[model samples]
Target: NSSDAFLLYRVNEAIRKSGAVVEFVREHIILENMVSIFGNTEKQAELINILFLPIVWGFFHIIKAFFSTPLSALSDKIGRKVTIIFGWTIYTSVYVSFALIVFLPSHIQIPVTFVLFTIYALFYAFTEGTEKALVADMVPEEKRGTAFGMYNLATGVSTLPASIIFGFLYTYFEQQFPGYGGTFAFGFGGSIALLSMILFSFLVKAKNR
Candidate 1:
């Protein structure tokens, strides 16, 4: 069909938008990296001061291994909806906490900041482990390959615009609200929550399924 091409294009656009929103959030975080915000020497000194980089690497791999088993097993039992809700809830809470940390007085101890960041990682684990499973639940096994391919295409295509938008927002917010990265995090998390709600409403399973 001549119109099949047009429909695919529209589908691609929708996929792009969804991915762009996520990428926009990511780019904001990356752009706000302390190294970029400060400078190389400053970033190096800060990392050394905290011994952060190596510790972070070790910590994440450990956490990933620890969480992967339970999350995967839980998804099999409780179903994807519950797991996704838990994941998003955890994700939102972490972002809220992160945002609060930004607004917290600058004099707060480094350890306190580290704790907040760790909470963020904990939620990320839930999201990462469960999201693919949730997608599988929604798509038929026969179409899983196509669905995943489309999802990947959407992610890749949308990332460009997402990065651009996030860069714009991050710069604007930094100038306007200096030292308030947490507020941005809160906003992003809220947007995700809204999207989640909308998805719940619209993306229902078939009656037979």
Candidate 2:
């Protein structure tokens, strides 16, 4: 999910810097092009964080607030494994949809991006606390602390390599494929997420059986 996050960030930044509503530049839409247009990386990043991220996150937090408690309660009723798997499925699907934004007409990009981000917030509501509960359910009471520490450590550690790999993939693909590199990187991340969901589902099934 962190990989997907980083790739999506790049995609959003690219879209923002490209002037989503106007056709100011005619070259391939990548980070460098954004920098070139904006005159520097810092300004471009600032504009996105200040102008774009706020609106997206504002809607996201609203959706998350509305859905979080219900999703957690649903997980308790339906079981953690099922809830987590379903969340991962939504996450993967959202990433795939994010990747496909390049295929859509330019006029709808902002609305579509906001909708996907909102869905992603809902997905987080389902998995965030539920996964920690699943960890607690799996491990013994005595070793719960250590189990959680290791679980968090693994997720945190994986983010560094995930970021590096996806960053490189984005740059490489953008050079090779022009306007489609970010999409490729996002699609790749979504594929990885989908595979993870399937493997986790199998493990959960076997454990329950």
Candidate 3:
């Protein structure tokens, strides 16, 4: 029951982190492109940072807080498996959108980037707490401590290599493909996340059977 949930949590964390590294790289690439397009003057860069830092961050956090409880309730009603699958679907779709955004004209990229990042924050609300509850549901009262510890350990370990591998892949792709390298790298990472979701679905199904 919850065992598969725990396993999926670990796998999802690993892949999510890996994909996130690529996303980070993409952000830097985007930032650089923006600087080049808009000029490298300090005042211009400061204005750009101002637009993102407080406004985008605050907007996303507000939206996430507003939706978190509703999503948690929905998960309680529909089941953790479905909720997690939904979150992963959104997560994968966000990355896919990021990949596609690379093809759009530079003028439209900034606004689209902010929208996608906000959606990613919203999707996180769906899975963040619900998965922990799923772990608790699957374990015995006395054993939950151990179960949670192990879950944390698995996810923690997964994070270490995820960034490293993603960084290497990002560098390789950027070198090989020039403008589209970051897109390819991010798409690759997103595909890995999608594969993890598929595996998680299968694990959940097998557990249910």
Candidate 4:
């Protein structure tokens, strides 16, 4: 029961930090394109390449590495459903922000992007390993092997198609719809995340440790 909804949601967000990957890639592609077209400054590119990108990524990993264990510990203390929902909440917000950042002035986008990047990293800390922990939490010790196999299967098979569709929506739809592409892509993602969280709250009977 719990694992059923959990399985479905994991299919969509099986790769929890995927939002981060999409975020940065969009920044490099769409944001940079906008900057050049608007003629913000050539130095901006050099600055990003030389300094900003690395710091953003470095900070992300640093935060994830630092907090992942603690957050997972928290999951043990609190409950998997609650914390998993919390992580999905983080994902939805970040995706929405990434989608909406296009509306901000070019000057502020970099710093704003950096902040979102840091925040996005937290989703991983909250959900990544905890998700596996959840499979263990939900099933009998004897059944855990099958549960984990199914879990891994959901993750692996769903990832490729999900990635393809999201990228298509982010790039192709944007090209087709102009300013609305990201709104559609990321907004849709946020909606899915929100829906999943809500559904999980209702369906998952997985007892927490």
Task: Give the better candidate number (1 or 3) by TM-score.
Answer: 3
TM-score of each: 0.62, 0.79, 0.72, 0.73
Give the backbone clash total of model 1. 1
Candidate lDDT scores, in order, read 0.51, 0.75, 0.63, 0.67
Model 1 root-mean-square deviation: 12.8
**Which whole-number lDDT from 0 to 100 does residue 157 have in model 4?**
86
The residue-by-residue lDDT of candidate 3 on 29-144, one tens digit each, is: 77656555554555554445444445555676788898888887787778888888899888788766765665665545456656775787767789887777778777888999
- lDDT per residue as tens, model 4, 3-77: 122111221231222333324434677765644553345454434343444555677789889989999778888
Model 1, range 1-209, lDDT digits (tens) per residue?
01112212222232232342223323565533534445564453443333443454466467766776687567677766665567666655654554454334333423444464465456556656666666666787998888888867876787676545544554577688875432563466457665765586468542222
Q: lDDT, candidate 2, residue 99?
A: 73
lDDT rank order: 2, 4, 3, 1
lDDT of 4 at 165: 69
- The best candidate by TM-score is 2
TM-score of 4: 0.73
Q: List the residue pairs that clash in candidate 1.
A: 99-182
By TM-score: ranked, best first: 2, 4, 3, 1
